[model samples]
Target: MSRGTRAPRAVRAAAVALALAAGTVVAAPPAGACACGGLVDGPAYDTSVSSETAVLQWDGTTQTVLLELDALSNAPEVGLILPTPAPAEVALADPEVFRELDALTAPRAVVSDHRWWPELGFGSGSDGAGGAAGVAVLGEVRLGPLDVTTLGASDAGSLGAWLTERGFQLPETIQTALAPYVQDGWSFVAARLAPEEAATFDGTLQPLRVTFPSSSLVYPMRMSAVADDTQSTRTYVLADHRVDRVDPTAEAYEPTVRFAGRVDPATVESAELAALLRAGGFVTSHEQVFTEPGTEIVSDFVFAPAAADVAYTPTYSVVADRRIGPFFAGPVLAFAGVLALAVLVIWSGRRRRAPAPTLAPRPAGA
Candidate 1:
């Protein structure tokens, strides 16, 4: 796609007035890839996504997804789109939920004497033509600075056109990417920050919570193929058993398990978060990088219970102190003592021999 001319400052408001479309949940910086799927306006600006995180909690019949993204853009506003299997309820999610999950499933710190440090969506139908085009505007709500709309479309073309009509620049590549989801009859949640609020939008955005019904655990990813760069997606799944990603096509591409173990709901401060984990189960974390999302990812991530409920936690060895003081003190001290003893023995042997020879000589003289 051609990198269009930089949007003029005067046009910023007009651009913001257009739909800042969004879908699904997950995050990255403006330079990085977006999780789930979304498109950003003002490609002329240095824009990308970073630090994308998604927390999915499934309790058999219902699923709640919390999404957060660190978006970097000079544009007046960015657009994000999310696709769900069913109509979804969108609201502002507690940022603390992600913090708590980070703390919960974070790599277990193993101290080994030495220390190393490391470190959406949618609905729509405001336009009268929307209903006729097989696109249903299921609902719309405003949360904080976000205008969220939920929409259902019978085909990808209609969905793409709908977003384009509202000012989202949907490239042909992105339109093709949306085909599968639309074919599967998925609903979308489109969101954008209000123009006034987005003008001063710092990269840090409030997380969003989307609740919907699903028979199985899943994270929408098909729409991410529109990303121009590779995207790193980290997802935390809270379920009754240890869960893992299942490639419907059995492709080699799959996310590595970062953590899979049970957690206590009481430890969580958010009542909503705790309630999701109230049934006492495991929280599995997965990290996947879509280097070529357009080709590498052909399906949304569908998770299921692992064959074995083994627990896995990523760990790193940390040296408590880099100083050799304690680690080598004992060995160094012992070596020094042995060296001293050896020197003493050699000196005593040489001095005694000399003395014996002198005594013999004196006796001979007498």
Candidate 2:
């Protein structure tokens, strides 16, 4: 999804014309590692996916996936190919849902005063598818500025050829990457921005929600191996209990849990998002960088409930002040007090050795 593949010349020309007519300025794609659920093709502008975020909510029988992509492109048209285990119902997700979740899970900041008699020091830290023989078009719908198409294919080759025929420009590596999903009998979801929508795209794409029947909580990621470089992914999962990432292939790499706890229903502003959270009170946030997707990510990310539903909140401490009033604390204060005592003792010793300032002073007084 982050890799940039050029569209056919015809598609490019059409996109250019659209941009010109819309009075939109066309620019070269910005540089960044691209990551996507499937393959990405841009008509007039080069596209790169910088990062991806997904929120997965699973009940016992169904799963709802909401995804947002941060990408840069000047194309008047952009397309994405996503593979899923079952047919999906695709629609626009409230972008505010992500914002609300972020606010809810953000790391708690703890500030402490470092009274440095001198002070204390501290540290802290912190799809779609279709086409070709054996490819069947399942459904298509338009939501806002997006055109979404769902397709099923018997094999990966047919699916790849079909997309290429439709100007997706699939590379051999990407085609190879699709084999496993096809072999598993998965369906594909293809989404594209309408010309009007693409013209208005700024680096951020509107979030999309896909709901389908799934027995296990999963985030499709195998196809992401086609990305040109490392990919960074952030995933939020809502379930009955805390969940941990499981790589079916048993790879050594796994996403780190950033936050895990039960979310209060009142904090969720979106009625739709809130309903999903109500089914599963706990949320687990995970983050990982796929350094070598080709080898490291041999399978999609699967998640299972952890043994315990323990809550986790990442917190850090900050020193607010080094001095309180005119007194220093900590090591500095101890050292100053010791020095002051030492000087007093030395002065007392010298006075005692001076023979009481001599009798001369007494004679003068007499």
Q: Which ten residues in a row have the lowest lDDT in candidate 1?
A: 13-22
Q: Give all TM-scores, in the order shown.
A: 0.74, 0.72
lDDT of 2 by residue, 1-366 (tens): 112223322222111111000001111122211333443444335555544556787776777777655555444344556777787787777767767888888888888655454324796500333356888888888766556677788978878777766656565666777788889987877765554544344334457778777878777766656666666666788888998877763357756678899997777788866886888778888877766766776666778889999899988887655653554455566777899999999999988888644444566556
Candidate 1: residue 181 lDDT (0-100): 75
For each candidate, C-alpha RMSD in Å?
Answer: 9.5, 9.7
Q: Write the per-residue lDDT of candidate 1 for residues 1-366, one digit (tens) a residue.
A: 111223323221111111112112243334223555655564455555545566787778778777665544555434656678888887777678777878887788788774322212466412222443868899877776556678899977778778766656665666676778788877877776555554454444567778887877777766666666776767788778887778652256856778888888877898867876876358888777776766886767787788988999889987664434555454565677999999999999988888444433456556
Show where candidate 2 strays beyond 4 Å.
1-36, 42-45, 74-76, 112-131, 196-205, 249-251, 322-366
What TM-score would candidate 1 get against the native?
0.74
Worst 10 residues of 2 by lDDT: 16-25
Off by over 4 Å in 1: 1-33, 113-132, 322-366
**Which candidate achieves the best lDDT against the true structure?**
1
Give the whole-model CA lDDT for all candidates, comma-separated.
Answer: 0.63, 0.62
